[model samples]
Target: MPSLVPHLAAVIFVSALAACGEPSSQAAKAGPPPRPVLVKTVAYADRVTERSLVGTIRPRVETDLGFRVAGKVARRLVGVGDVVRGGQQLASLDEVDLGLQTEQAEAEARAAAASLRQAEADLVRTESLTSKGYSASASLDRQQAVTEEARGRLLRAERAMTLARNARSYAVLTADADGVVTATSIEPGQVVTAGQAAIRLARTNEKEAVVSIPESLLSLAKGRAAMTLWSNPGTRYEAKLREFAPSADPATRTYLARFSIPAADETVQIGMTATVTIAVPDRERVARLPLSALFNQGTGPAVWTVGTEGRPTLKPVDVAAYEAVEVLIGSGVEDGDRVVALGVSKLDPGQIVRVIEALQF
Candidate 1:
């Protein structure tokens, strides 16, 4: 029995070693093996990149309605928000003073005309007498000069009368374009100076969103494309990059982007805040990977990629922009390359790794 104890102990030790070396057949078949992460290959397409910004809706052009001549405002025909047509009288100044000036000018012009006529008659009489040898030639010449001077005075008086009529015409403040009155400063009986703003007018149904974009990102679009508008279910509106400021603002380091958004519906109003998204052109296709695939090497950006035989390799890449769930790669990688999406920072180059599974293609 003492000799059998050593053999039994040896046999138990060998059996325990075998059991630890090989998994049981039942345990291997009982549960499913851990599957690797699934990855899908990315397809190349012409996708317009978008950058969104908050903006404000304003009129393309606004004008202040003011009187060209000074007078007391006698009538105001339009109020704020009232739609008016071109040349429509928005307000009127007191015409009594202008009318009096016109009357005085007319009287002066009539008197000048009468005096000119009388001088002309006298000149005719003197010239006749001189021809008949009853008057001196010098006397006739003097009368003729007097008649010419009176005629010149009459012409000057007539011009003054016309100017007075024009001044009276200026008393009526008229709209320059068909627009809605946005403001008014004068009511009836209010005295106003020349060029005093009497009303503010803007195009009724024309609107645009003015956005300030960083100068670094503004070169993406030279012109325009479809943009998303914040109004109503986030409707897409066709916007054209009509104008851009030549200079960037020193304080904000941004340039102004003027988008020409067609106001098809009357619902668009001035001063309404808007969100602007400009679509950037896709020039070149580069490698795109998940955010977890990136790791900083203190010098720049780098990513881990699975090489042949499932070994991790460090690949340097230039990052253009960061997307929602992906980082846009500008260079240093080609399409269809396998990238380590997770645990990339924990890996060293040329290290052996077990692929978890395929991820997004």
Candidate 2:
């Protein structure tokens, strides 16, 4: 009985050691905990595909203003970004030369008038002499011709004076319409030629967004579009197709499109950056996933799809289009398939995962 007790004690000691090691063995066999992830069940729908393009807000009627006559610019009354009204004086040239020309014309007109008066008096005196038989008829006729020549000279001088006055007025450049000045090409003291673009005026009554569309998607840009300003993102403006260039740009091979904004507010300024969203009618049903779920390992695009047993497997997908927040998958994933919506890069193939949240859409 005493020997049996010693053997039993040794057996109990060994059993205690084994029990102490059992926890470590179990932990080693268990490996890592299941990765918690957010997932969404893939579903196909008739999704309306939308494409966004960056564009510039511009006026429908933008005009380049210039001086009517050539002269050195003496002063610029309006500057860039200045609001101007019709007939507002925008700039002026040095009027010294113009004034001199006007004065010369006026003097010539006065000289011609005085000469005509003198000739008329002479003709009257000659006719009186001829009537009294003191002058010959030929002398009176010659005097009459002189008076007519003087009258013609006076008329020409008056017309020259009018032209000089008009030229003087042309030295001052004025706005032709009500608009905002967007650009100024000439400064004070700079010389400008006739019809040279000195200022760019954008009419404020109407506005539009201008963007370039690629040939592949030109057909989709026909209908109404939506515009959101980069400065004010919350406000969205509706735009309709106003005009599009008939031919593509030779260098870019892209078509220029202009969309009229029916409800443009004061916040929408010229030259502001905007985004145009064009929605294309899509009839086919396609699966959509959040952009975070997409994974590209150099071979092609893929996503980590969760199986029915809560295991994640890498599946290659054909992406039709990519949006700001989501991706449209054309094929390789069926409806009801669970896809990792977030943290896809951290997931491994065939790894078990616990879905912390299931997302829709």
Candidate 3:
């Protein structure tokens, strides 16, 4: 009798449970609800892609400031990065020698003037003597020649004096325009030659971003660009294409371009790294869809769009570009169409599909 009643009762309960589960299992196998498939909506927009480039913040106009006259550097008033105004003194040469030369020239000029006056006086007296028969006509002619020679000497001396003054002025190196000193090549004791580049100044009037653009992205040089500094990326400056190299650089094979930033501030200094972005627009209207959504029905690449009838249809599209995971469709798909992204091959053209919204956590 050893618990036979309990065993029999357990067997009956198990049988009842199995009988109830068989119908449910059959119903599940028969498809209680259609499975939800991954889908993407089609919405074509005007194509505009952005390209970012690395470059330097450069002045639109840069000049190498040099001394017009040669001399030992006496005092450099402004150094690298110093702000200088137009005609502002940048450095001064040792003026001792230059000043002495100027004084000597002045003295010579004054002496020549006196000599000319004396020569004229002699000529006048010589003419008077010749008229009174005290001097010969040849003597008067000689005096006249002497006066002309003196006058010529005076003119030469005056010109030399002017030149000496100009040379003295050149001793003090000054800025030709308002700019910042970007480089310095001389020390106080260094002797520099005339027209030797001593300092490099970059004009702050119009700042530009200079970048070497690759040949594939040459269209960026013509497009309206924008810039941002690496030092401060949050701020942005609008820019326009100011200069584009007609040919590519020999080494890098990239086109040199300069985008003028008329609104650049102090933060955009010379040599600072910057990023230029070009938003190049395309005339073709396109929409992006996952690559898996593309299907080949022997005619061309196509995507499965679930129409209002909840039926799948193969719609052919022109592939504008093929990317890693997405394809740009140029045409053949209207906006607001639901495209099947995954398991597109399982769906049949005649099969009526139930649209189930995807549950996202």
Which candidate number maximizes lDDT? 2
Off by over 4 Å in 2: 1-49, 118-148, 280-361
Q: On residues 1-361, what C-alpha lDDT tens digit does candidate 2 reach at each position?
A: 8779989999999999999999999999998899899988888998686789999999999999887778899998888889999999998999898899999999999999999999999999999999999999999999999999999999999999999999899998888888899999998889888899998999988999999999998876765589999999999899898999999999999999999999998899889999999987677778878998899989999998887788889999999888778899999899888888989999887688898656454
Best by TM-score: 3
Residue pairs clashing in model 3 are: none
* TM per candidate: 0.68, 0.59, 0.72
The models' CA-based lDDT, in order, is 0.77, 0.90, 0.87
Worst lDDT window (10 residues) for model 1?
A: 34-43
Can you give the lDDT of residue 33 in candidate 1? 43
lDDT tens string, model 3, 1-361?
8779999999999999999999999998776355456778888988877789999987888998788888999998877778999999888889888899999999999999999999999999999999999988999999999999999999999999999999999999888899999888888989999999988888888888899999888877667689999999999999899888999999999999988898887777788999999988888889988888899968899988887877788888899988777789999898988888888888888676766543321
Residue 238 displacement (Å), model 2 = 2.4
- In angstroms, the error of model 1 at 72 is 1.1
- Candidate number with the higher TM-score (1 or 3): 3
| Model 3 regions more than 4 Å off | 1-50, 129-135, 279-285, 288-314, 322-327, 335-361
